[model samples]
Target: MKGINITSITLYSTVAFSSLFRSCAFQVVPTGCGGSRQPSTPSTSTGIGIGTGIEPAPTNSNTIHNNHVMSDDSFGSRRQLITSLVPSAIVTATGVSILLSPQLSFAEDVQVDPVIVDPVIVAPTGEIKKLFNEGRALEQQGNIQASQRIFAKVTKLAPRFIYGWAYLGNSQVALGSLDPAENSYTKAVNLCVESRKEEEKLGIPRCNDLYLLYLNRGSLRLNNGMAMAMAKEALLDLEAADSLRAKPDAVILQNLARAREVNGLYAASDRDYTVAISMTSNEVSPFWLRAALVKFQLGDTMGSFDLIRRVENRFSEAPEVRAALAAMLYAKGDQDIDTARKKFLEIPDRQRLKYRNDEFLLNTISWPPRMIDNIKALSDAVGDAGRVEI
Candidate 1:
């Protein structure tokens, strides 16, 4: 297999580590590669930091409940924003790994059975055709900005060309210009709807572009934070996309689960997550981490533990996974503090601050007063020893 660009791999690895293990305090070894057709946007790498939400605890259970309400209101709003932003970041970071690692074929290794949607055939004449192919080549080469320009010209030359608009949106997404991408996809969808009427009159088959357009648009909207009024709009688009395709993609199911999770539909989200996991049959996916978090949030401690254990087993060298496993063990309330402490102390000094300041672990861990004091002392000692520069 061709080796991925080490620098790009490091950048993505850092982002994934920082975002997923913000509270876990583990350094991640960089892995994977970007897709050839995707834009290597700097913004995608820089925006992967997850916010911490720790606060002083109340003295009693009643006060704790009140604080939980207040905290939920505040955290819920902020989390909505994070949820919207993180999905696009994750997709950009992780989606290209299959392309990068030729040794691990998706069909054989991951067992991803993607829904086979019929391809859309578009024939453009003269300069339009020349420019359209050029744009596609540029995009395939990762020259997203250049591709965007060419697609813009194509759209201008042929306003009614649905594929032109859709490709334009694709380039815009790679460039991290999501709002413009949304507009381009919306245009393609509307045009597809109009063209479908004409095709029906002529007894032509349904245009497959509509499904692709809706799928892309729905993913953008779903990842951009469904807490806004646009969530329902995103859901509708996803459902439309799902219905148009003969079979549903696992990615679509995953996206739907995330959207449902954010909408407080835990049961439906759980079902979708289960289906997606079964489809992939790969335990090390970010989706598994997400499902684990959802399970933990829903008080399914054992389920969360099982998921974390699977990740830990697969990525044993991953410090983040070890840290997470330790935290989850502590949350289980029956684990020996000494064992958890050993795992905690195994993390490097440079990464100790993240665990020390982690809001979720602090709130969830059933630490005795002496254990808390000892952990704090250890963290302070590490801070005094000097921090490692990331």
Candidate 2:
């Protein structure tokens, strides 16, 4: 991923439930994963990162122990969110995603380039290809159990075959075998890395995007039994591969940002959140910015000031924006109590009441944990900071 221009690659699955890949990204070939071809490199590495939603990246290969909690994943662990499945976020507040689920956001609909390895490497035997394709066919027909059986055999027979490993992981996921799926994906990623090292030795350039970024929304989800630290190492590695995407989705960026923030890579995370904020819908952007603001508040007060200044300029008097800023200011307590008071007063009573509604703030507003606490204090203020202030 070191400055190589990533050409386009289609998303597909030889596992199960990949109609989206057939429709949106590539036309699934009945014979193999044949589709529109882009000239990409030939190998990947074993870096794993946590990622959620869709697509993937080559992340670090830390063998995370199973006992660690979510925060234990490291500084801004890659927020690899497999949506509902992957345990996510550097902090669960503001919904920064983490970990690859079975259906993986990073590689949920992966369509591998047939020429995955350099010509020097021995490719899978014809018999293995036949079996792998057979598995793909069964998976396409929605017969996941049949596909899982075939793919498992394929991987066992051809352990070095990257596609075999990938397909095996995909099938395992469809069969609801998450731990086994992670193991399969891990092996595949290792092969990708090993292949890339060979390419480097041979002076060949390869783009291992398929393995590097295979965190599908389904596949990106963490097994509840796995340590959060191990998941974070994977997510961090996954985020490194995000560069290949043409129009990277906002959720991926935001989740990645949160992981970076947790890792204390403040500048990089700030940039990710800022860009993510721009790509998000107006209704949603403010809260994301609110999350960003708090993260900066904790790490860099100057950055928060810069961000709030931009928020005031761009959103102006938007209700959520005003409420967020007011909460932030009020959280500063005596430092900006007057400004917080004024900002709250500017809100229409109806809007103010909505912020007062804890349930609404929690469910709908998606407020960050720190800001949520601030909102509580602001709601319970008295005298100068109260509704009847001078």
Candidate 3:
């Protein structure tokens, strides 16, 4: 931002001061211009000489003389004139000083101090806090049934408490009570809406809690695979979660993208997947893999291949990356089979064991006979290497 020039700006004020004097009562007498001084008529009061020792004309005769005449009344008028001119003279001097000085500048360079407001501290009711803490402790300890009992009591005692309801919902989900969990999440969402105004005034952000509730419920609905209606409901919940979070989590975005894909929203799903991938810092992020899968499904084979190549370059030794790369190579047909076999054999048996039950990975890897034989040979080699080491 450019600053205003104080010196340039003061010039206008200097001009204004000059304008004030333009309508002055006094007129400037030109020096060395020969002219007779015109005489003025004298009033009944005593007269005072205003010029160079000029005698006052007598008022008794009705004669007009070529001499200037001014009355005592003019003294008061001159005093008023001086008083008015003094203020303007001072202002003009100040403006001129400012215009001429090098150090003086406008205060435009000074930055305004930011107002830092302290965060509002919200203290939950003692009984509710205690119950909530107990529930959390039990959940952390993996005692889901005990946690559910505590969270259930919390909801009964403080039905309006959003966190209580959220925790209760999570507990119910852990105990495989999907219906009760959905109901609890719904109740929490309603309370969050009702208390939104108070939350804003108190400088509290409860939207994240609402986001979690919706996301959990949506994920549960999707994973249940009961009906198409459930999938649509999951999409709605994920959308709500996306809107509430300040910066949407990559996991939530990936989930929403998958839900969109299931509902035949290929374009929207691709966009969400792209955003999710961009949000992630990890080169081998699951979102990247998921997006690659989406691209392949949409017949963007070249795009998918590029994404897989990126993962392979960054994590060449990772089993998941190698697995994905081999699958893509196999999709390209016989010309790439030798390269794919070499990549497939590089995946260690121990690494494959860790993801054996991963349904998504299992579905992703195109386990052809050659790939299976390669995996078996690699496992045998690993066993032989272990025996030789012993």
How far out, in Å, is residue 50 in model 3?
94
Ranking by lDDT: 1, 3, 2
Candidate 2, position 46, lDDT = 24
Off by over 4 Å in 1: 1-14, 17-123, 199-206, 225-231, 246-248, 315-327, 336-390
Q: Which 10-residue span in candidate 2 carries the lowest summed lDDT?
A: 61-70
lDDT of 2 by residue, 1-390 (tens): 221111112223333221221111011121111121111222222221111101222221111111000111111223233433545435457786566444345434444333333232223436865675577566656666787788789777766565555556555544556577667767656655555545243323232544233433112332222323344664554475455444664545554554454344556767777776666544333324544454644656566766666656766766666766787788667869788878877877655766666555543443446677777677666232244321
Model 1 CA lDDT for position 57: 16
C-alpha TM-score for every candidate: 0.56, 0.42, 0.48
Better of 2 and 3 by TM-score: 3
lDDT of each: 0.48, 0.46, 0.47
RMSD in Å for model 1: 24.5
At residue 204, candidate 3 shows an lDDT of 31
Q: Judged by lDDT, which candidate is best?
A: 1
List the candidates ranked by TM-score, beginning with the highest. Answer: 1, 3, 2
RMSD to the hidden true structure, all candidates: 24.5, 21.2, 40.4
Name the runs in model 3 displaced over 4 angstroms: 1-124, 175-179, 197-208, 225-229, 246-249, 309-327, 337-390
